[model samples]
Target: MIVSLAISGYRSLRNLILPLGRLTVVTGANGSGKSSLYRSIRLLADVAQGRAISSLAREGGLTSTLWAGPEIISRAMKQGEVPVQGGARRSSVSLKLGFADEDYGYAIDLGLPQSDSTSYFNYDPEIKVESLWAGEALSRHNQIAGRSGPSVKVLDSHGHRVPVLQTLASFDSMMTHAADPKDALELLVMRERMRSWRFYDHLRTDREAPARVPRIGTRTPVLSSDGADLAAALRTIQEIGDPVQLEEAIDDAFPGARIEITVTDGLFEVLMHQSGLLRPLRASELSDGTLRYLLLIAVLLTPRPPPLLVLNEPETSLHPRLLDPLARLVTQTAERTQIILVTHAQTLASQLSGCEGCLHFELRKELGETVVDGVEPPRWAWPKR
Candidate 1:
């Protein structure tokens, strides 16, 4: 249940704070920074997995992803009286990201590493500061733990600063290295919760897609990112999950169509049975749109829902008629888990915007920075480096 998300110095998201709800739909035109926002959330998830540095490296390092705009977009620049340009440094180069739930908040600061002649990874970004605080807003008094440079400290039960680590690696996150279950139980809890957040980007439904191939079956409570276990996941839903909802979702999209799984030896494959068909169609025989719709159904109806689920442009390849059914599925899934849907389709966005506990954000570029139209950002404060 993240209440707010704050990102700064990341691509077009230069100093952006967004409020979240049980179901948050983010939509905007092309080049409006929707993809940047999606990648930023994935980067935050990488931190909890101790792969933040490598993730950034794969994206061409901190310099490539850092905001390209000036430190300040002055009134003169906005008025077209002056061009946007960088000025002398007012603060250190830092890329910050954070999120706050109902009871706690966490933030991390990354900056350029100090120059070193002997180090090959000198250009790697360093974790400058990390903070975990109580409540929705971060303040001095609510901070439970703070990590500065290579040192980590946490507040004990009696509210005294207790040293946790003396030399944490610059690439490793405190969420992974300093979250001791004994001394820093809050860190451990937060770390695990962050790890539980699931992300599903564009699912492949091509001829050779993994979801179309038969795979060994298991009682899958969650669908894999590649949807390799689509059959097992659907079978799991039929056996232990909400079978009624599963059938309804399938029928909603393809009127009289239902799903069946056949097992040969240990391999399971998905089959579709539709009205007025001589026989069921194999996964490989299904159309791209149909297969994608089934994949979405499997994902949204997961038996073991994650704390947070993010879907990036899920409406891709889906027919306009299927958007309503997909929206209905998302609305139902939001009841059990927090969902953030990044989409460009106004039809899909319109269908879910009116639902209860849903927040809609239409992002637009203003002077090369992404801004939410007609919405004030929630209260957020980044930890000073």
Candidate 2:
């Protein structure tokens, strides 16, 4: 499980370190940088998939996502004695992200690309440094792999640095290019673990949502990010997964209601069997809240649970009455997987207040930077460029 998360120079994150538990609930007012923190985690996962550069470009590149505030918010500025303003940068322009579990830690540094006349993608950021180390904290003695600029190196059996590559692209990640099952087995293991992380944000339940359309039947152990395979996912659970838990989750949300899947011409569709109804309701006929709730059920009860699962604003469009059931489902899922829930609903947070292995954080903005009070930040170290 990830014990700590560190992000710097990313939007409102500025320099933030957050401790994590088995079930971490991050709650805060709007504009308190909740979404930024969520996206930073996604960015880290993208690195393992070799999509980090493209993901940053899709978010309007480094300039748009970098912190806009001053390098230092001085005491005089906080006292209102002087206006907050930027000064000559004392360091290079860089954005850093990292996370650490009990066994290992990883960090990456991204900076502005060097001036090049041969390329036009100047807005694209270059990865300056990457490090993978042992234990929860990074130290030179525990470093297993290190990359500087275009060169990559790994530790040998004698704990000596062995050069692996001299031409690794700046847009690529060592997690993808330098991992060797023979020489760098640790990199391969860590890479796959990071790739197993899953994220869900703003699942659509509109009239044209994909979940409403019938799709070909296939055995699905994992729900797609868009929930396009909702029927297959639910059917998989009923077949090989914990069917009792799925049914209980449904009944807990809507008393006496259950789920059914119908197939016609090899196309599968979801149907809801509820009390006091003449017939079951099709996925397209169900209300937005009902469909969204069902999607969450399919996600949380996945047969193949990921190492990490992140849900952003899952309470959206959910009724107040359903918050308790949702909280119960989340806590149950956390037993098998690590979960990070970012929510704006105090009711949901209250429901999970005293659950086992649960940690709660309330974020707020201070001088345009996100801050969390009353909890000690976890020990973390970032790889230098």
Candidate 3:
């Protein structure tokens, strides 16, 4: 489990440190940078997969995503722009993100590339620094794996340097590259951990959404990002996973309404049995709220839970009455894996906070920077360069 997370120079999240728990809820106003914090976590995961650049490109270029605030501040400068403001950058333009897990921690630093004349991918950010330490939750102690630009090195189990030094490409991550498997064991472990960090953001329930359409059945232990195979996922859970929890969750949400997945020929479909209905309704015929609620169920109660699960804006289409059921479901699911819910709904946040075990972080903007409410500065020490 991730105990603490730190992000700097990413969007409006300038130097923000947040403590995590079994279930962490992040709530704030529209522009308080809740979404930015969520995406930064996603990007940190991307970095370990060597897809950090791809993820940043998808968000926009790195320059556009970096913080836009002034490099330094002063009392008079706070009032107005200083005349002698040289605009000299104090530190290297770096967007750093990392998290401290149970026994290890990992951090990555990305910066703008040196002016490349011929390369068309000049806008791409380059990995400047990456580190994975053993247990320095308070200080920079054991150096398990460390990288500086192209030069990469690793520490053996005995905390000694490996014989074979390695070189990594500017565009690639030390986690992806590096020769000799045993040399970078921590990096490899960190990479796999990051890849296991699952993210679900706004699963659609529109008229033409894939969750409402029929798809081929298969043994789906995990739901897809688009949630197109909702039936197969739920059916797989009922067959191999905890079917009682699945049924009870559904019944808890809709009273007597239970879910059943049907497979005709090769296509998979969903039949929702609700009370007072003459006949069970199909997935395509069910209301948007019902389909979305099932999707949430399918996501939370997975047979194979990831190391961390992130749900963004899950309360978008859910009715106010269903919030309690959803909150109950999430609180129950937290027993299996770590969860971070980034939401805009105060009611859902409040309800989840009132749950048995949940750590809530209310984000607020202070001088254009996002900070957790009532958190003392430097309460959580970050892994620094």
Candidate 4:
């Protein structure tokens, strides 16, 4: 479970630290940086998978995503006494993202690459610093493993400094390249846990959406991010997972509606059995909202839950009346996994906040920066470049 999350110089999320709970609901107005926060978390997960540089590149490079505000927002600037402007930069160009979990913490820093005349991928960001530490907060004594540019260091079992990698690549993460099992035991463990972080953002439910079309069957313990294997996943849950919860979730949302899977020649198709209907409706015939609700159920009640589950705007096509059921489903799912729900629906936020062991945050923009409402931000220290 992540106890805290910190982001700096990422879109409107300049210098933001947020506390997390078993079920964390983050809500805000449009352009209040909710999507930016979600993207930042995905970027942190990408780092552990050795895809951080490529992920940033796909987002149009670091320069495009970095904070465009002045390096420092002065008090006068907030009061409109002085116009916002950038002068000399007091710190290095860095976009930092990190989180502190139950027993460990991890942070990574990305910066513009040095002028590389020989490489065509000059716009790619360079990994400047990375750190893995013990406890909820990082400190000098708790620093277990870290990377400074190309040099990677780890604390051995006897607490002696051990050099793991001498010439790590600029675009590669130490989590992937230097996490030796023997020398960097903690680093390896942290990397695997980070890899288990799952994200579901706006699953496609349109007529041509993959989830609506029939696909080959497979033993799917976990639903795909695109929900292409929705039938197999639901079937897996019905067989090995908690079928009672599955049936209850469906009925809770659609009253007497239940789900059925039909497999023919290895192709799996989803069928719905609802009250007051002679014939069942196929996935392709269901409304967009209904399909999306089923996708959410398949994800939240998985037989094999990830260490972390992030849902972005799950209330997208859901009706207002269904928000309460969705909220209840999410809260129930939190018993087995940590969840972070980014949404724009006030009703859903309110419903989630009413749940036990849930944290609610309303984000607002202050001087063009995203700030959590009426809460003191967590204390954070970034690893120096």
Candidate 5:
């Protein structure tokens, strides 16, 4: 589980450290940097996948994502004695993202390209530093993999830093370059663990949504982000997973309504068998709420849960009446996997207020910088560069 995440110089987040838990809910007002925080986490995951630059390019380049406010605010500015004015930056600008866990920790730093030549791809971001450490957090006992500029080093059995590769490409990461199973076994493990981290942003359930159409049946242990194979996923759960939870979830949302999957000539369809209804309604005829509830059930009650699961605004388009059941499903999922939920809904945050082992992080803008409300420095010790 991720215990903490630290981000700096990204959008409105000047320098903020967030404490994570098994169930962490991040909530904030509009323009309070909630979405920025979510995107930052995604960027970190992209680094592990060796596509961080490509991911940022889709976001209108690095300049647009960088913090737009001044580098530093003077004491007089804080006291309202002087107007805000631009000045020379005191330090080089770099976007940093990192997280610490009980087993290991990883961090990546991104900055501008060295040569600003006139080229079509000059806006591409470059990785400046990447580090993978061991133990509960990054400390003296840690430092497994460290990369500085174009040089790479790894810790030996005798706890000595031995240079593995001296000259690496600027665009390529050591993690990707050293993924051979025979050599750099630790890198392979780290890559696999990092890849297991799943993220779901939005799922469409409109008139023409794919979940409405019957898909060819196949075993599905995981719900795809698009939810195209929802029926197969649910059927997979019923056959190989906890079917009782699936039934209870459907009955919890809609009393006397049971979910059934019908297969005909390799095509599979999902239906809701409600009481007092002569004929069950197909997925295409079910209400948006009903379909969305089923999708959540398939996701939360998965047979194979990942190490970390991130859901960004799962309450989107959901009615207030359904928030209770949705919250219950989220809490149930947290019991198996670490869940990071970012939501703008105050009701959802309030509903999860007294959840045991849950940490609530409320981000607020402090002088144009993202800060955890009422949190002071030294709350957690960060690894030294």
Candidate 6:
């Protein structure tokens, strides 16, 4: 479980540190940087997959995502005594993201690429520094591995510093490059843990949504990010996972309604058996809200849960009456996996307020920077470039 998360110089998040629990609910008003925080976490996950540079490019590159406000918002500016203004540069441009569980922590720093005449991808972001440490907090003595520029180093068995590799590409991450069992075993473990992190954002329920159509059946233990394999996943759960919990989740949302799967020629489709209906309704005939609810059930009740699961606005297209059941499902799933939910619905947030072992955070913009309400910022130190 991640105990803490930190981000700096990303959009409205000039400097922010958040404490995380088993089930963390991040809520705020519109334009309060909720989406930016979600994307930042996704960017961290992309690093483990060696797609961090490309992910930033898809968001318009480093400069476009960098914080637009002044580097520092002084008390004078806050008091309206002086207008906020930028002074002479005091530090290099940096965008950082990191998280830590009870036993491990990892952080990465990205900066502008050096001036190069031979490369066409000069605008690309480069990994300036990366650190992987043991225990809850990062310290000089606890760092197991470190990456600076193109060089990588790790602690030997005798606790002596040994160079692991050189010539690591700036666009690549150490998680992808330093996978040697002899020199950097910790890197491999950290990489796999990060790769297991799952995210779901805006599952489609439109007329042509993939979940609505029949797809070739496979024993799916994990639901796809787009929920395209929802039927197979739910079916797999019923056969191999906790079928009772699945049934309870469905009944909790819609009483006397059960889900059925029909497989023909290896194609799997979902069917619904509801009260007061002569014939069962197919996935295509189910309402948008009902389809989305089923998708959430399949996700939360997965037989194989990831180490971390993130849901961006699971309440989308859901009616107010369904929020309580959805919240209950999320709360129950958090017991087996660390979950972060970013929502814009007060009803959903309120529904989760009474859940045990859940953390609540309301983000708000202060002088164009995102800050957590009623919480002190955690102490954080980044590796120098």
TM values, all candidates: 0.99, 0.98, 0.94, 0.98, 0.94, 0.98
Q: What is the lDDT, from 0 to 100, of the residue 231 in candidate 1?
A: 95
Question: Which lDDT values do the candidates have, in the order given?
Answer: 0.93, 0.94, 0.83, 0.92, 0.82, 0.91
Write one digit per residue (lDDT tens) for candidate 6, span 114-160. 98999999999889999999976788899999999999999989999
lDDT per residue for candidate 2 within 1-385, as digits (tens), equals: 9999999999999999988999999999999999999999999999999999999989999999999999999999988899999899898899999999989899999999998989888889999999999998888689999999999999988889899989999998999999999888889999999999999996889999999999997999998889899999999999999999999999999999999999999999999999999999999999989999999999999999999999999999988999999999999999999999999999999888689889999999989999999989887888777
* Candidate 3 regions with alpha-carbon error over 4 angstroms: 74-86, 136-140, 163-165, 179-181, 377-385
After superposing candidate 6 on the true structure, give the runs of residues whose Cα lies further than 4 Å from its correct spot. Answer: none
User: Residue 55's C-alpha lDDT in candidate 4?
Assistant: 89
Q: Which stretches of candidate 5 lie over 4 Å from their true place?
A: 116-119, 136-141, 180-183, 376-385
Candidate 6 TM-score to native? 0.98
Residue 371 accuracy (lDDT) in model 2: 91
Better of 5 and 6 by TM-score: 6
Tell me which residue pairs clash in candidate 4.
none
Local distance difference test, candidate 1:
0.93
Give the CA lDDT, 0 to 100, for residue 13 in model 4: 89
For model 3, what is the error of residue 367's alpha carbon versus the real structure, in angstroms, after optimal superposition? 2.6
Q: Candidate 3 at 189: error in angstroms?
A: 1.7
Give the per-residue lDDT of model 5 (tens digit) for 322-371: 88888888888899999999998888887776688898889887678787
The regions of model 2 sitting more than 4 angstroms off are none
